[model samples]
Target chain A: MHDQPSLAELLQAVKHFIDETASPNLSGHPAFHARVASNVLATALRDLEVRTANESAEAASLKTLLAVSDGRSLDDMNRELCKRIQSGDLTATSHGLIAHLKATTIAQVKTDQPRYSGLKTAES
Target chain B: MQDFEAAAHRLFSKVFGAEADLSDINRLSGGASQETWALSGGHFEAILRRAPGGVRPTRPSAAIGLATEAALIRIAGKESLPVAKILHVLTPKDELGEGFVMSRVHGETIARPILRDETFAAARLKLPGECGAALAGIHKIATNTLPDLPSSNGSDQIAQYEDIYRGFDIPHPVFELALTWLKANQPAPIDPVLVHGDFRLGNLIVDEQGLAAILDWELAHLGDPREDLAWICVNSWRFGVTENRVGGFGQLEPMLQAYADAGGAVFSTQEIDWWEMLGTLKWGVMCMIMYEAFRSGADPSVERAAIGRRVSETEIDLINLLEAANA
Candidate 1:
């Protein structure tokens, strides 16, 4: 929908999200790093939503934004989320919850997500 | 006595009172997240947990904070778990970084001792299933009750997996493979539960009383309970006790059955199997990150680097399991 925001600008946007949306009384340390995480997720969710809606500018851009990662996916996010959770910017549950909401929305539109049957998780 | 003496004094004075006399301060080894000092305040016993860098360090993302763990300690105590009791959360005024002072408990928490302790080996045998049941207890912690806690549902965990891979800049072929399999073999979504994300042996504290405490809630979050089921059962956590299967304590079926008995809904072998594979991928990437962290000096611990090396073997284990399951 728009040019990808610069990392700094995105960071500011992340701060805005926490100030506006996240829980309060989070243990505060690792401010910049947490900012980056908030920034990345904020941008990722926005981009993912647009892409799922078929509004992403292009495919390559989507990949770049999502940063199809290697090894530990949460190493980066968790580091940030841990700080965020401690900071009260987000909660232990909120990160997963928000990601779930966004990812599910994408799945709903793309219908590309896996659908397992008779699995234990399914029974629940 | 180390630098922590004065620092502990400052923190204790800040939290308890000026009367607190901290003595016998010794730096305990093996905590990546915080500076853990086993110290006593003369009349009272306590452990001083402080921020590692002695500053409010920011993560790669600038908007986050580092001192939140101290609070989580208090939160865990409120849940009636056997975690250390939080006495005070203090800002490191002159020397110590922001940290919480907690009442320390006694137990052997190291993996090697737990595995090798003759006196405790029998107790160790009972741990895997116990660990699973403990996880179920942790999951029972309701999100709505924890003020300022983030909200999560079942699938939020996948994003957690994805975030680690994204951090690496190189999507691990192994992780990608596992992700592909996990996606392909996705289990039906279930009601979310609080997951002790690192429900492994080393993360647990045990005594003759059995399953006395669980540590390292730094990774705890809301997610699929089966993910916790799969985490403890992962091969790496077993430390070659894969023969034991239930996190180096017993077999998967018994562990799952024990978990089922503990009030968890019975999950199919296939679903637990998927989470197991995903657990391998998760741990593999986690170990690599540790290796990289050691190399980068962001955190330097020889054990962590060793753990990194140990994790690769799990990759081979993963392939075998996946093939066997598919077979």
Candidate 2:
């Protein structure tokens, strides 16, 4: 429904401007900050690309992990799951907890730190 | 620059007996809690660590005041603990509020150059052992001579982390799991010793030789010495060289062996591993705190927000730690 230069395209363009235009001219602290700003934009772009799929995957995974029969919002389900873990209803030894946590964290790393070594190792 | 120089002259004249011809004044990168200024005056060169805007903010957990930090540095120097020598503690008369001046010992504090650069290839090999020995010296600071310190053991520290995590009110199941595990597997308490709470590469001044100075005593506390030993090995401090767990410079055995050789407490790798898990979770919680700060607009900066994303890295680390333990 939107224009041809999509959200991702616009984000990529802005990030390129920062990396190619602003960062090259700047130096010292300002240059460092500009790089970080570009990174922030890149991360946003990654999230835009993968967020829906990741969230749906996480929701489905959480439902199975917790054995939820009723529908719950993803945030509420996660909060409930955390509470369960905190209360010792679920534990480190709890079946499927490790796999669920790994999958969920890997999903996060994919968006937040795609090149993170841990993610690479996990995938391999 | 003129105003800063004038102030510096006045401060030096008041703190010491004579005027100081100050030069090479540079503002060094410092933490959110403090600012660092480097300057040299004729024969006297020093780094000034001070609170922002000349007013000392309320001290955070385990951080002794800058005045006490100056004394601690003096104590560490007395024990030959690779600390910069303290020259002057600020008084109200100095007009530069809430900081102390220390003789600047120059070297790199950033991790990447220390870890990778050919210039520091030799230092990398020696750093693990040097760090272990320096930590040994730190632990040797006499308890009687210590400034008023808040003593803490494992449970006490866990409670502090719990308070911090709860205050943030973010749902982190990994953090909860870590907290639960730490509680269940509480390491038997050893007699408390002086712990360098943030003894990692970023806080060290490394050169071609090795560690020249142990900087950033802000997080000093009284706790298990193993806490100090394990914190340096935390994955976050490893930069990218995760294989070399000791600040991404060398292996755990050499560091531990050096610690034992230097008359420090001998701890099992298992104990250190436990503390490493704790350290990882603690860092994750700290990152969450930074995120909260960013979200609340208390410290609106890209750096803080980016650090928040690093919590996921810690989560992956926690998962790895837990999975290994489970296996």
Candidate 3:
């Protein structure tokens, strides 16, 4: 809150350094790892940008799907959703289940790998 | 490093004779479980696959050991399948640790180039048939002659991956849904055959003629042949060219036709869809496992940490597959 550069800005600067400066100077495995590091930073930046909204949306959908109250944390609700799915209480054809899974997973892929081909496939 | 090179040289000299001078010994990268070294000697080129420092680390239960890998390659070669010929299996006397030397088969193993590069256009056309034929030959190998290998049917694999997922102690509703679907739709057990558990693009060497060699026998096991077929069609292996379902180069129809023509069991697309879904779930769980390894400091690398994020890709893939199935 007291800094010139925000967290996202700092992450972007480091990612640019890796992609534009550090990576080109490396070769072979080191080069590959530099690219991966850049990707990791990029993913972090994306997650930071979207995490709050995505989490709240995911939690809201999970509450609807699980018919739970608002007091539970997202982690707690997700664990309940997982238990229901695993225990056969919820299923592929369960009401609002596929929609919830699709929405949640797509949001996650948007942050984790926005360019992943599966994202297009999932959305379409 | 010098000691490793000297030992390797001596081993090569002993195997290929003193006249076969060894040079250009370089450790090829990737693969955390095993080390692959590319070496040239006189007119011959070979690869050394070994465990580091003569000590074999405990690998996952799925992996067949290096010696067994060599044995499978030898058997596959005898079956006239394209494989790197096992030049020598190391012994304690060799003092270079557990490994085998194989005559290298040259080709591109990277997926993107094989999928998009014009250099592989002709290879791409012929690959599905060739891959089918290669798998046919592998599946036909008499199991009695094979070294003792673990075997699993569809349910076994589901249980295995589910156990692994449980071990990670992370909750992903998508994974839970996938597990539920996989269990409900488990295919009936079939007569086990030699299944190349990792038969995707990166494990194959494709030149202009297509599929010069099939490498990485560490995951070789006795299981359903459909496991091999479906594995190649997994979205993860397709790179980005998702239209070409069979390793991002060919359609499923030609591959299945070639499989039958080559004396492998005939399979319909519907029959293998279950396996494809299972393969997707397995990869998603594997990504989680990689992340856990990184978190536990077992193998702290950016690559391992990055793979954890890829689980979402698989999750989305599962949703798509499930939606398609439901449709």
Candidate 4:
């Protein structure tokens, strides 16, 4: 509604410029840093694309694991989970805890590193 | 800005005791704490490890100081271990601040090439056993002959990580869980020995023949020998080829057998497994620290920011390790 080139599009355009135009002219550490900058932009774009759904999915899983439906933020819920685990109220063998941990972690990896080899193995 | 060339010339004159033609004084890549420069003077070529800005040497909590590091390298060399020979440690007269110069041993330090390049195919096959044998030599160094090093115990180590994690103020449930698991499973104390804390693929210089020189002793500490063995086998160090467990070079048997064969203490697979999990968590915490550095503007490297994302990789690995053990 606001503009034709959305946030993701703009980021991609900038990343393309860095990768194709800016990088070739540079050499040594500058070139290496330019490449890393491009990768960071790519990750930022990926995060923007996946952030909302990933947060919701994580929140849903946390609700099921913690058995709460209150409107706590995802960060708050994760902190609560950590507290429980650390205090020994919940453990690795706790009911549904490992499943929740594994599922949520896999979801994170998907958002952050879709090409990570462990993704396939962790899924099964 | 300090004149690097003039400083290098002064350093060369002092070490070689005469002026010689020095060239190709280029900085090698990798490592953030210490600056490494490769320079050749006349027939002499060496790598200089120096404190940046000519100030006092700074290192992680566990490191012995640079003077001690120089001494340790000398001792390791005497034992016939494949270590860079120490040529000179900085003296006040040198005016180059704190650090040491060592004779450069040529090989590959980059992990990807060592794992994938056709040039190192033969080296890959034999590296694990050689690493194990080398570790045996490290563990045998007598503490009495060494400078006073802070001996780290399991509880103190975990407590230190806990402190650092809290300081970061970022709640990582996975890391908290790992900390709990580590605390619950703290290994019974063993006789502490010299641990090459960062003994992984990057720290080892690999030639076509095999490991040419063991480098980067900054993280060297007095701890369990199993810490060294397990750290090298951490998943991240494998550089994507996870199948070859021993630093992505080969299986565990050859390494372990070579260790035992070389008169090193034989540890059970379970022992190594425990240490490996700990190693994964430690690496994750270290990554988080890098992020904190990035956040605080101390280090503005994109690499550090990217490495922050890698904490999740360790999370997945931690879950798998714990779940398998629990099962």
Candidate 5:
């Protein structure tokens, strides 16, 4: 593997610099952009921590929901799920549809924005 | 930049007087094509909103032109609705561009301070009702007397946003589900009125007393008035205070009551709920549009890039709304 600092650590360092140093020192649009940059880094770090497990879970859910045995990529499975929903084959009342959507969406929000109020509402 | 300042100076001199001295001219936050500027001259304080580069190119294809926006503001002001008074609509002779100067309304437009700060504790209680009444006033403006504007009902909007979403060609299962729900539950048509297409926290100016003014009429159009009511209640505009649904300040019932008190058409909770779900989906699609713009390098700012990730937040919200509806 690479040297001491992991990918998450490197991202955290950049985020720290932006939040603690760069953002505080700037003003106006630059300052706002600095904060956004820090947020981007934080999101990156979160995604790095959870991406593998989340993607596998999402893939398995999609496979079962779509009832496919072949090894389709996650993107292909997701596109198929969307097509089925769009075509009226899958619906809110359809078996396992809402469950799959909820699980997938919650997993995404966990990485995208764990603190979003919708997560709390969805979990409840 | 010097030329712009000189032109603005001349425009102010013509309007305020030959002796009018322009100072503190600062460009405020706005889109790339649109510009909002704050300026003052002695006792004269006003805001300048314009399409920079001296041409009106209707960028989004939804905006009623600057002149029409000014007219709407003037008409709204005449109806005693809280809005900035339009002072002057620019002429070709003014040479500054297509825009208008208006008496600045002093208030906070930022969401956090208005939602959470102790300074606005009193205003928060009154704001939801005030917003309801203001929206009632907007919807009541006789559409026949207004300038030609686009109009759309529920299905029309669904088609419009769906078309745009499809254009992106990215399959969002949640968005597809929302589309299905929206189509299956289209609200019955009503006589279309002047709908302030974007009536939310950021577009409202809240002062110590309450809502001082409604700004940003670029998205103004003719549609169902419930669209305005539900737009405010959308969770995205709640700014984290999701419990109080009406713009994160108060509950929905009081706001609906205030709207009725001010002569707006009474609406059922179920009716408004439909529109709220639609509003959430619309914002999600809008986030996708912003992400596309960023990805295409049209406006490659960190802000635009970050907004792309916010689509998941909308997904979670849609899931909650759907679950609640199903329950």
Candidate 6:
């Protein structure tokens, strides 16, 4: 069973939510943010006894990497992580996958544009 | 009504089999969590709601596995204000993920329709009064009617808004301002009425016969009846047709008159005006969730990312509205 997705998929989720939700004023280069995200998750994984390096060989068994990544705002951390990935800072390799996995799965992907709620209501 | 021609017909046809027909499936696009499609089929032409963005497993858990739409439809049906009759709720093991089937009711819900469409022009005049009474009916219903709602919700406006705010981790200055306004303009402590959280001209569906039904009660709560009254008149719902102050689709005079006639006492203009400020403030706060969602990448969709822009758009207007209301 697929527990999580590829790094590409994870990167896409981060890009999507950041583009859709993050404030226009989210300062700094996304690369730095992504590194911060990866490091945060990496540190958490180490503490949780998840995995060591991103060799892909040992990555698959490290399910607990993102497990310890709690209390932190999921979106904020993920956005910072993805920005770094896109900037080519952190690679979405094994061991580092939790940072990539969580970079997606943000909340409230909606719009107020008429297209979303169309000017029309339901039939009475 | 646009044809979601991609996978819709295929999905519905497969699920409904003999009972399905492909017709106009317009998008209702009001939800960040769900997407409601307005469609027509064989004997049934109605809405088809599905989870937004990603696909997940099928299980019955709040905001998790299943669509929980059947639950929404069931609750809406019990409220019985005029939602489309639920014909069937489904978690199609295949296409369109999870959703439900229902009978389409006929009516125009666009806020301006009540003012522009000859069909609803007359009916719009009567809604305010009927809206008041109907809101009362919803509030008076025993809490047991909805076992699913967290029991901690207080039976009042501030409590409900507080719950919604706390549920979403974001701050809204306008909400704080509105909260202040409502506190200052408290209306003599009348009995709480059911506040149709999303009630307005656009949220209302008008039938050919007129004054059809209320729609989208996802944000419904018990609160000051005037909140509903103020909500119906919020300028946002005016839909640019400000001439008809009642949602910009009908005049306030007649609507207020009808409410008064129906035993709804006259809420002071200034007091109700404060509620109007609250309306804008609450909406602005709610809009912040969209921004937070996009930033977090929880549900990544182009549409949601675009929605983040509206927070600023609404905040500016809400600020002005609050200033004017206070003045």
DockQ of each: 0.02, 0.63, 0.81, 0.63, 0.68, 0.03
Q: Report candidate 3's interface RMSD in Å.
A: 1.1
Q: On residues B45-102, what C-alpha lDDT tens digit does candidate 4 reach at each position?
A: 8888887666753334566667888888898999899999898998877777788999
Q: Model 2 over residues B1-327: C-alpha lDDT tens digits?
A: 565567777766555557666656767753666878887767867787887756875433567778888888889988877889888888877667899888789889999899999999999999989988988888877788888887887888889888998877778888888888888888899877888788998889997899999988877878899998999888878887877888888999999999989999888898998898899988888888777778878778787788788899888888888877777
Q: Candidate 6 chain B, which ten residues in sequence have the lowest lDDT sum?
A: B57-66
All candidates: interface RMSD? 17.9, 1.7, 1.1, 1.7, 1.5, 19.8
In candidate 2 the C-alpha lDDT for residue B219 amounts to 79
Query: TM-score of every model?
Result: 0.64, 0.94, 0.96, 0.95, 0.94, 0.56
TM-scores, chain B, all models: 0.84, 0.94, 0.97, 0.95, 0.96, 0.70
Better of 4 and 6 by DockQ: 4
Q: How well is candidate 3 docked (DockQ)?
A: 0.81
lDDT of 1 by residue, B125-227 (tens): 6776686676656777766654344434335545665676667665233344445556656788887676666777777778876687776665555568888
lDDT of 2 by residue, A1-124 (tens): 9767998899899999999899999865577678788988988998998999998998999999989965798888889888999889999999998789889999898888777756655666
lDDT per residue, candidate 3, B202-294, as tens digits?
A: 889999988899999999988999999999988988998888899989999999999999999889898779999999999998888778878
lDDT of 6: 0.52
**Model 6 alpha-carbon drift over 4 Å, by segment:** A1-124, B1-32, B53-80, B91-98, B112-114, B117-119, B150-179, B187-193, B260-267, B312-326
Native contacts recovered by model 1: 0.00
Chain A TM-scores of each predicted structure, in the order given, are: 0.23, 0.93, 0.95, 0.89, 0.94, 0.23
- Model 4, span A42-119: residue lDDT tens: 778988988898889889989989888779999899888988988999988789888888888887777666766556
> Which candidate leads in DockQ?
3
CA deviation > 4 Å runs, candidate 3: B52-54
- Give per-model CA RMSD: 16.3, 2.2, 1.5, 2.0, 2.0, 16.5
Residues B1-327, candidate 6: write the lDDT tens digits: 123364677656765675687776666644446666776666656666665532452321123223343554456568665566665555444345666656666777655556677776567656655666565555556545543442211225455555666566554333444454456555566654545566776567776555666666545544566677777776667766644566765666665566665556665666667677666656655555555565677646554455454553344444445445533
Model 6 preserves the real interface contacts to a fraction of: 0.03
Which prediction has more favorable DockQ, 5 or 6? 5
For model 4 chain A, give the 10-residue run with minimal summed lDDT: A112-121
